[model samples]
Target chain A: MSTRFRPTTLTGHELELREQVRRFVAEEFPAGEYLPGLGINAEASPEFSRKLARQGWLGMVVPAEYGGPGRTAVERFVVVEELLVAGAPISAHWVGDRQTAPALLKFGSEEQKRRFLPAIIGGEAWFCLGMSEPGSGSDLASVRTSAVRTDGGWVLNGQKIWTSGAHYADFVVTLCRTAPLDGVKHAGLSQLIVDLRSPGIEVRPIMMLNGFHHFNEVFFTDVFVPDEMVLGAVGDGWHQVTSELAYERSGPDRFLTSFPLLRIFLALRARRAVGAEAEHRIGRLVARYWVLRQMSLSVARSLDAGEVPAVEAALVKDMGTTFEQQVVDVVRELADAEQRPGGDLFDRLLAEATITTPTFTLRGGTNEVLRQVAAKSLLRGAGRAA
Target chain B: MSEEIELLEQTLDALFARHCGPAERTAAAQGLLPERLWARLVETGLTDLGAPDSGAGLPELVAVAMAVGRAAAPVPLAEASGLASWLLGATGLDPADGLLGCATTHPDDDLRLVGGEPAAPVVRGVLTRVPWGAAAGHVVALARSDRGPVVVLLPAATQVERGANLADEPRDTLRYADVTAVAAAPAPVDAAAVLRRGALLRAAATAGAAGRVLELALAYAGAREQFGRPIATFQAVQHHLVVMAEEVAAVDLAVRVAALAGPDTEALAVAAAKVAAGTAAAEVTRRGHQVFGAIGATIEHPLHHYSKRLWSWQDEFGTDRQWSGVIGRAAVGAGADALWPTVSAPLDPAPEAALR
Candidate 1:
């Protein structure tokens, strides 16, 4: 009955953009330039981010008036999907390009956008999220981070953990409580763009299981965020952060994180006479990947059309991350390459993917949390129908 | 959808509601032909929607097939209107006047066209699992001839042992001893192509059935109470319903995109869609039953009407294993370097346009 589920066909311009992005990746990410499966954050390269900025790939959805390409969501999806499948080093500008820019465009004051948008598009300003604190990972509304109103700014005192790229980021859009909790836990929360280089702020690297220093435990001791840096409105952090999560959850990165490894596994299988069972298994994975891409593209199209398909975006992330993890498992089974340290390319990539597989569903909102979001949306729909 | 399609959908909805109710469907499942309903359907020109060489676009056929599936109509509308008519048209034969069915076997199946050359081929051996074989007046099938794959129209008057699938729809096995063809023509496409078409139709039907099951599950979840509250309020039940909804959504998109793909990519698209639909059908039906609890499992409930059809249709043209194998081989054969290109190729409008 609802046309929301209808499949979308790529327009000629979108197809052309896909080819251009593919060519850009091919030329830029020549084999061996970047290792696969390092996860998005661990693969940071400032130089590569600048190259994308030069090519107008970053901030694609930002309006041209703010020094962006002013592209549609589908066009942005084409570029991001190509970058992701190639396992390009997109971490340096990933957060700012993906969600921060979009959030700023949506809810930022003109002065804030003029100050932040150009730098973000130019790859000079990198952003890391601060929604999750020491105890509030999935339960974001229960964040204890406080920003006390002061003379000309807010004195921020909080700790944000699992903050990817915070050490390299120029700013952290921290979610802080501006007022004491009333009847509602979600109320009184505000988003303040904290300068990472500001006084009294400390960034400590948190090493991953593979010893990758992509995450940071950021602590703020009376750090000041000027009143001009507040995003959207005061007490609107819950809504603004949730909207940003939609952008974060529905991107090509969710599923394509392990695709490079899949491509390698497929290449390995192609070299030999694979058994029928192996072929079926690989084919099943490819089919699932293809369908997920289509679904994700549809969500992108919806976003471009100015619809907030939060539930649809959640579905994509839940299914896409699950598929991403499965790709790792399936590739491990298909290829006999040992995931050893400093081994062959196949072995190394597999090892990285194996270690990173645990985070595919954990990051960007755990799959369980996303499923609850989707289920609640469905129940709401059912209620509406009844 | 255009106003015409929307109006057509409403008309079909009313027609099914009036004639294809629970009792009528039950009686039809028991081998009684609803002659009046069949005549009414034929009078509506629904049977000729996929007439031989009609050059019908897949979207139109998919619309009709989905309606038939949603109604769980016991008639072989998909076989007659979608597959059989398209096959007949492919071979340049006039469309059959009445109900028509089709069969495409695995390469290892025993069915073959042994004699009489290409112009006048003769079918031999037994054709198994022919949809509506006992009920149809004519059957169009893809069989291996001396030259290659050929399309043959066999009259249903030949000896046949009637059978039924999980949905209790006819899946009769036909025993042919050099049965002469009423009309035979060289197939423009290979057996695999025909099989893919059938699989596409099945995927569309499965999507339709899956959609209905989601609706039913949601409605039931909203009404049925447990622990002093509606089950829909329960997180576990809500989760199951969401999973079903996601599967339905995926299957629906897969079928539509596959239908719109070009010929070069149609096989891969159809194969992918079939795998998605077949896999989703299993999960959606399982969850649908879970949501309805004991009532959904009982024969008296109409839920089985859709669930059983989904289960049967998923494995009819090809199971998940079969279609996934097709897709896998294609991907592997293309190798990794060419994988993205193979997937991202621009799709031609619709197959019927090129055929025309």
Candidate 2:
């Protein structure tokens, strides 16, 4: 294998995409227009979501065959990372554009692809994942959401908690236990695309610590789905869900969530003369962040190559999240020592980041689960089958 | 660019495991390990590793330093053989196999060249707590002067007396006190750069030790049952273990990148890597001890051996606070623009640097 890496820096195409995305964010949903409040749906709004669609930035990852740019994962990473770092009001279309679109393009039937992919690319459609029920959070194998065979499709009857954007999502990709495969608890599950407007389905918003309705407890009461809505073959839900997770976990989003605050921290730190000690602290932080970004991008390249780098993704997420929290901690300490403005943008950004950071280790997968996964992969070579 | 160095890493790993086990390390601490083992290391071409045309070079030096650190070998392999050999090589001196030490700070002038005392002295005053001093055949001291930092070689046999460094290592305090020594030919090597390299290699050793501690803690966590199941299954201990793993991963990456950084950026990388690895070492060792409960602190337990080494090595080349201050000064002086241009610079290399 060649030791030469694809340049450690971004190239022209990537830079162009970033600048375009940055301009779209600035012009369409400037911070003044929709500065996220400390609530559940801090940055989610329909108008803001559609604005992205109209500008053709939403389908940056969607293939041209699906009315999208059909760009490389690197390009997608470049754009979304910039948007996320800018703290754009992007929650409304984030999942749909980021992972769901890619997953559908990979696993969706041609018809399913034709139906949802274009809308997703056009930014007119939105999505949420129905993988985690209350009892089965990161332990997705234990999902009890059942889907019984019906005349048209499958009748889904189970509940999914922490379904982000379900309140506004047009469709949800639901994972259900279709048949009782006896060998392992994971083999029996299957994925079905569910329409949010279908009868017997309930979407009740759950107020998070941030006090936003960004996520909802989506209940399925014998919810009917057309036969065409079944994603892939029966008993493939585990495989599909794992694929989705690899996408969700590996991107720049894992590390760049605190980027807005990073900018603010840099600006504020520069205003005062940082002594040797503080400079060292900040430099070390930046160095760590840079290395983590490189590692995360390596994983992204792996994903683009169609490899399931589950363990690598887990490692990145674990390291990236903790480092982000560390950055928050360091910045807070620096802020206190410097006695900088408490009400300034930097302070607000820091506070906002702090509130969101707890989820860093908990969200995608808890740190404990991630470590177990990491050890098994390194020691036992887990995920070899997939 | 350096495949030989990469291969040398495998060789050092094999050597360390063969010669520096717990018992051998303990024996070395007591000066009871067979003299032949050290002789064999020298005979195996490990001692002359940092010497140019000695078959092993910069890469081998790095690998050996890390390997010895990992083994927690009580020998001053890094200082005696690694740093001393490096400083000697820099001055175009033949660094023979045996004990050697290097000091960045030394006081003395106009004392030594050939016989009793020549026009200029090599090293003066004394460098206290010089690692590997007790056993080194020679100690190389670099004194900052108006010209630059002049490299001076002080043989352990003639001028230096030994002082205990406390741990089992061969550290010693030396008294140069107007001692006479040869000027030794000046070779083109930056003392600061060599020191930074040594610091980075030291951090690598600390990282290896920290990784072992984490592995031990993880294994213990797996089997040491608490209320019902193994404590590894417990969220609290598991979380801490994961945190340790994260630190290990971070330091591991930092060290590797710093190792590969170019001359211009090497110092910065070394400073950053030291801060990370040093901080990780202190924290991970403490947590590893915590997981072992009271047993880890007892002298009977081998865990202390690794932890003590970690504590000592973190303060050897550079402390966490010291490195942090270095980084902080650079960041502040560079301002926000150059502070982290690799990350913050508009995704494009600054055009001016491109022209070059």
Using lDDT, give the best candidate's number: 1
- Tens-digit per-residue lDDT, B25-82, candidate 1: 7667876566777888889877767764445677778777778877887777776777
Q: Superpose all Cα atoms of candidate 1 onto the true structure and report the RMSD in Å to 1 decimal.
A: 2.7
> lDDT by residue for model 1 over A1-386, one digit each (tens)?
32254466577677778878888888876765456544484478899899998988889888989988899888888888788778778899988988889999999999999999999889899999897887898888999999998989899998999999998999998989999999899899999999999999999999999888889999999998899999999999898888766678778887778888877766654554287888788788878877888788878877876788788778888888888889878888877655676876667788888887898889877777777777767766766866
Candidate 2 chain B, poorest ten consecutive residues by summed lDDT: B347-356
Docking class of 1: medium
The Cα error of candidate 2 at residue A222, in Å, is 4.2
Candidate 2 lDDT, A1-386, residue by residue in tens? 00111113355666777778767766754543333332222477767767767777776767777678777776777766666655667787877887778778878899988898888877688888887889998798998999899897888998999888898889998988999758799798988889999999999998877565667899999999988998887898787777767677767777766655655666665653466656667777766766676566656666666677676677678877777788878777777654333667666667677777787778766877877766544433212211
lDDT (10s digit) by residue, model 2, range B84-175 = 77667766766654566666332222322322322245455566567656566666776544455556766563455554433566555677
Root-mean-square deviation (CA) per prediction: 2.7, 5.5
Q: Which has the greatest TM-score?
A: 1
